[model samples]
Target: MFEPEKQLVGEWVLDVRPEEVRVLVSGFQSWSEAELRPLTDLQAVPMMKWRHEQGHDPAFLPSGEAGVWRSHTLLALVRPDGSGWVGCAVDAAHTFTHWEARVDGQQVRVTCTSEGPAVEVAWQDTADVIGTLETLSAQLGRNMNAITPTPLRVWCSWYSYYRDVTLENMLDNARLARQHSLPFDVFQLDDGFQADLGDWFEPSSHFGGHASELPAQLDALGFTPGIWLAPFLASPTSKLFRDHSDWMLRGEDGQPLPVGNNWGGPYYTLDTTHPEVLNWLRELSATVRGWGYTYLKLDFLYGAALPGVRHDPSIGRAQAYRNAMQALRDGAPDAFILACGAPLAGSIGLVDAMRTGPDVAPYWDEESRRVWLGDATGPSARNALHTALSRWYQHSWYQPDPDVAIVRRELSLLNHHERGSIAGMLDIIGGLRASSDPISMLDEEGLALLHRCLQISTPDRPTTLAQSFGGAVTHFSRGTFNLTNQSVTNLPAHAYLEQRL
Candidate 1:
């Protein structure tokens, strides 16, 4: 059995619940200026707070060298064999503004800012990390007992167009979605459609300022038009930032803080506590809904919830996030909320589909080949799929979206083996499936694979992870259907199914 311990330092108390999980608690700071020398979780390094505030899951190794790093909210502890439990400071804000998790060899620690009743934690010892999160899911008001998720086959505009998506290209894909024989529920537009980051109502010249009508046009063609929005973010050049800098979350120096660097951006976070900002979000989201867009992919969302000096200091980042997400829910009550770049603990009851991994890039490995902890929150298909596995327990909270499952062969630089791997991984793991490929362009073989991947997990039978070698090779057998990122060419069909899920 794993042992649990607690330490009291400077009015801060680090306690491992039930005394069964062997954990160490301490304050944490992210290594911000990390150079070509990539640091995993174990190494003692100075970490910056801004890097992982929002974006893919921030994977950490662990450490306990105090003075080098300050305390931050959130920590995990496990036995040497990885059979312990993990927890986050769910609503523990009144006591401490900072919390962190650290791992030193087999020891783990969780430290808070000052230690108060505001911290409520989730704990479980299932040996499966997924099970630990599953326990946390319930405490966050997302009881798996109440949710019924549908497997989705989505067609997104990002992987194919990047930020260069135009009205013409999106319309063609919508048109193809209708005529294509494949089964698809949502025809979604990604980043390129927005006029700016937080400014949603205004569309660029490419959209002809007519994005409000695009959703209806797609719906008319037999698809649920899905729209993407970074509800909490605004680019520095955008109208939202220019007109309402005062309404954004700011630093101690009285300047709006940049949450994370993405899309060649120093994106700004909106202060959800400000009534004006919330009102604006409510109106814009409703307008999108009025235009017939039912699926909302909220990206770059960590900004709104990043631990920062906000307009309302009384409200914690969790509540700030809840406030903003509540507005989206209130604004578009009927829409499907696909939350990406979000804090996993606080997002429990809000979103219908949670992006469990990083942005699945077209290629497998780039600068950081080993799925660095920093890159875990950055963009990488390999990391995306890999993180998806580590977060499988989240499927019980919301339909886990493993990002885009790319199947196209011609335009993509990914080899045939790599293409099948992404598609297969998502098919087996993700509750929501989306292909960021132009359906009209995909050849027959690609189209066939897309069709085959659509069989979803039923309410009575959810997919399970049978075996994995850190995502390099994964095998999952859901009922009679056998699946693996390793191509069928590599593993025999019988052996694939014979393995349990």
Candidate 2:
């Protein structure tokens, strides 16, 4: 019954239900309206979900412009408080028609930018976001296609090992896990094993050209074989770059565009729309999955969908992005796809889990840049915790994977207090939980901390807004566990440190 101000410039109707709300927006000044061309009769979709994308850029913004905004995806609205939630049913698969939810204070608009005549959107609220999401998960997997994600207490070679991890490093870590009888579900080989960014089939020189053996060895050790690949990015030093310069996505000037400065120099994007690149990706996907690795962490995935001059100019960026992901799905439907640095809305249903925040570095604090980055900087543990907690609602559908929990006393810049805080936050967030520290390098104290974290679970959804104290002390409660940056003295143990603008 609430009508908007005259200045709002649109006629809108809302259907409010007990569990959810549906908004039908029409009668705005569209080009079609000017032409008086009526929309054809079609069945309105039953389920429309929103996703608060933790976009590629650290400062995630809802953007319709391609490449400029790599993160926020369709139905980009979030609950904004208490339990910190959002959910998507994946019905919008390859069917985005500019379903961006622009929020202004309490007011928001869902605009239809594509050829679609109008936009139909849905919003649902619940005390337990995960409970609702599992229902959707079951619904999503009704055909029994979606893979159930196992709790990933992965022994990842990221923070401690990074790109320096070799076959020896992985074997030594796996050996340590076996000797100590450590609890690890997956032994992941992060970035270093690849011969080059685009050469997924070849092993790096560090591995003596047999990286495939690493996965089998880990599996024999009673752990799932996990591997990481930035499938969309090809490094300048890669064979793919040298062999097929035409495969690279070019800007309007016909020169290859650099995605970002990651694997040394600026990495070039693979034109997913190109037939050669598409087939290459398909073969790569099948080869990796066929190698018996159940877990694949696809990183820098935003590059796949960035706005650029593609082999086919007719396709939209999102369309190109979906096509690339669909190729991987066609190749490996059963593998658990953990999307890292992926475009938020573009990856629903296509991925089993997503790295919803920047990488958690060994260094804990970002006080100097805290004001500047404000939870958007990469390689920050505190910023990761902040982002994970805020976008937690997405955990109800695809799992929210905050990066790793580093507790090793050596080679880490995080102190005891910072380490404990990060572990606590990860446990509370309830997604893929992994320790990047090598157990062999960990002291008794670090091992004990990991043991305690394994016992922790997601807390009950909080009903109140997170209270902030001075700036340093902030906390929120999940029900089973409560996490805080630091214990808020003279107040409660927690305060919600989500975002205060």
Best by lDDT: 1
lDDT of 2 by residue, 1-501 (tens): 111111111222222221222211111100000000001112111111111112232122223221111112222221323222233323434433333333323344333233212223333455544345445434534322443365567778887677778888888888898887778788888888878888888877776546688877887788899888888788888899999999998877898877666555577889998988888888888898888888888877777765567898776666787789989878888888888766554566688877766677887656654433322334676656555554444554467677777778888877766676577667666777787787788788888877765553553332333332321112345321223444554322332333221
Which parts of model 2 are misplaced by more than 4 Å? 1-91, 95-119, 123-148, 368-370, 373-375, 455-460, 466-487, 490-501
lDDT of 2 at 23: 18
- Candidates in order have lDDT scores of 0.58, 0.57
Reference-based TM-score of each model: 0.77, 0.74
Given candidate 2, what's the lDDT at residue 495? 25
C-alpha RMSD values across all candidates: 7.2, 10.5
What tens-digit string does per-residue lDDT give for candidate 1 at 265-369? 678888888888899888878988888888998876766655557777766655777788888889999888888766554566677887766677767655452
How well does model 2 score by local distance difference test?
0.57
TM-score of 1: 0.77
**How many clashing residue pairs appear in each of the predictions shown?**
24, 13
